[model samples]
Target: MKTIKVSVVTPDGPVYESDVEMISTKAQSGELGILPGHIPMVAPLQIGSVRLKNGGNTEFVAVTGGLLEVRPDQVTILAQAAETAEHIDLERALKAKERAEHRLNEVKQSNVDFKRAELALKRAINRINVQKRDF
Candidate 1:
């Protein structure tokens, strides 16, 4: 079977490195699916799930802001911060969502880390979305 070498990395370190049959992820432009031997491209990724297909299975990794670089032979994801569904805490995600929502509601715009809070909320939601799927 044809396989694409894929890597997911953050400033902290590498999150994943494997040979995937295909990959699907949310990009700023839109959702995209990448298969082996795809045309080279570079795109900004959005806050959502990175789907990896291996054999007949698919895995989900929740990613925050990132950049996806698709090359003829490999694919790389450089995420700001990311987490897998297995590593996520639904309760904690809920709490973060609530906290971000609350802060957005009452905090003064100047003093708030609006972008950070928003990104957190999105990440939490992404976790929920991936966790809900049957894989």
Candidate 2:
């Protein structure tokens, strides 16, 4: 099987580094997928999960937002924040999702920043959803 190198970096440090048979993530325009020998390009990634596949195995990573650069041999992700499924705290993520929902609901009456609340909600949802990926 063919594989491509993948590295996901965040503010603190690199969160994931491995060789993947394929990868998929949400891009600003839409969903993006890369395979070995894919065309080189740069794209803006959105708050969502990055899915890496190696043969029958798969892994998921939650990303707040980032930039994706794909080369013929490797894919690099420079993210604002990232956590693999194993590292994510389900309880914390559920609490965050609730808080974001509450903030979104109070945007009008509480003078909450609508855009900020929306982004937070999306990020929280993405984190929670990443936990649902099946092995």
Candidate 3:
């Protein structure tokens, strides 16, 4: 089977690099699935899981809003932050979720940044869902 080189990178560094038969991720526009010979293009990604399928196994990566560049033979994700399922700290994600939820509950407070808290909640939930491969 043909495969495409996929790299997931963040400001800190690369989080994942591998050859995958298929790559599936959510874009700001919608969900997208790319194959080895996919057309070259670029898209803005949402905070969600990137699924890389090779053979019978599927690996997951959580990304916090990024830009995805795809070529005929390769795919690159330039993420603000990213982590593979194995590297995601479930406990930390849970704590973050709790904190975000608490912040959201304080929406009445003028000092609370509702949008920031909502984004944090989304990111935490995304990480937890990706870690569980809930997709």
Candidate 4:
């Protein structure tokens, strides 16, 4: 089976690096999937989960937002923030989700950044969902 090197990195450091058979994630245009030997391209990634498949193993990573670069031999995700499902704190994610929900509600009655709150809610939800995946 063919594989391409995949890496996900954030300001803190590289969060994931491995050779994978395929990768799929949300792109600004829409859903994007990359395979080995794919043509070079770049797309803006949104707050969502990145799915990676390698052999029989599959993994998930939650990303706030990022840029996805697909090259002939590899794919690199320059994420603003990222976390593997194994590293995510479920309780914290739940709290964040609740906090974002509250903020969104407050926007109706007080000064609040709706867009920011929405993004936060999406990220939190993404994290929670990724963590919930059964391997």
Candidate 5:
């Protein structure tokens, strides 16, 4: 079996680096699946989970919108924020989800940024889903 080198990075640092047989993630346009010898390209990512399959196991990384660069033998995700399933704090994600939901429900408030709250809710849900390996 062959593998591709995958690296998930953020402004803070790298979140994941490994050799994977397949990679699945959500892009702004749609979902993408990459293999070891995938065509080189670039796409904007959405707030979602990145699934890396290797050795009959799948690992998950939660990304908060960024850019994905794919090469024949390598794939790099430069994300604004990223966290692996093992590192995601479930309690914190739940709290963020709650806060975001609260903000969204208060749409009549002038101070509330609906779009930002919606994005936050998406990110929070993404983290929770990734941590649970829902996909």
Candidate 6:
């Protein structure tokens, strides 16, 4: 089978680098699935799980917003934050979600940072969802 090099990078470190049969991620428009020879393009990604399939195994990583760039032979994910299902901290994520909720509820000021709070909540929710999914 033809494979494409997929690299998922974050501020902390490189999260994944592998040759995969396919990669799937959530883009701002919708869910996007890519394979070898996919059309070259770029998209802003949303907070969600990025699924990778190689051989018979599958792996997933939660990403909190990013840029996904695709070429004919490679896919590069430059994530604002990334975490694998195995590394997710459920308690911490839950706390972040709560904090974001509070921030969202208290947006009384005209210049409240909704985007930041929204991203935080989305990241926490995405991590929780990724960690709870079946392999």
Where model 6 places Cα greater than 4 Å from the true spot, the runs are 108-112
A best-first ranking of the candidates according to their lDDT comes to 3, 5, 4, 2, 6, 1
- Candidate 1 lDDT, tens digit per residue, 1-135? 899999999999988889999999989999899999999999999988899999888888888878999999899999988777787787887787788788777557557777777767777777778766633
Output the lDDT of residue 92, model 3. 99
Query: Which regions in candidate 4 have their CA more than 4 angstroms from the true location?
Result: none
The per-model lDDT (C-alpha) reads 0.86, 0.91, 0.95, 0.93, 0.94, 0.89
| Prediction 2 global C-alpha lDDT | 0.91
Candidate 3 lDDT over residue span 89-130, tens digit each? 999999999999999999997589999999999999999999
Better-scoring candidate (lDDT), 1 or 3: 3
What is the lDDT, from 0 to 100, of the residue 19 in candidate 4?
Answer: 97
Cα RMSD (angstroms) for every candidate in the order listed: 2.3, 1.5, 0.7, 1.4, 0.9, 2.3
TM-score of 6: 0.87
lDDT of 2 by residue, 1-135 (tens): 999999999989999999999999999999998999999999999898999999999999999888999999899999999999989888888898889899888877988998988888887788778886632
Q: After superposition, how far is residue 7 of candidate 2 from its true place, in Å?
A: 0.1
Kindly give the stretch of ten consecutive residues in candidate 6 with the minimal lDDT sum: 126-135
lDDT of 4: 0.93
Global lDDT for candidate 6? Answer: 0.89
Error of 3 at 60 (Å): 0.1
TM-score of 5: 0.97
The C-alpha local distance difference test score for the whole of candidate 3 amounts to: 0.95
Q: Give the TM-score comparing model 3 with the true structure, all chains together.
A: 0.98
- C-alpha TM-score for every candidate: 0.88, 0.95, 0.98, 0.96, 0.97, 0.87
Relative to the true structure, candidate 2 has a C-alpha RMSD (angstroms) of 1.5
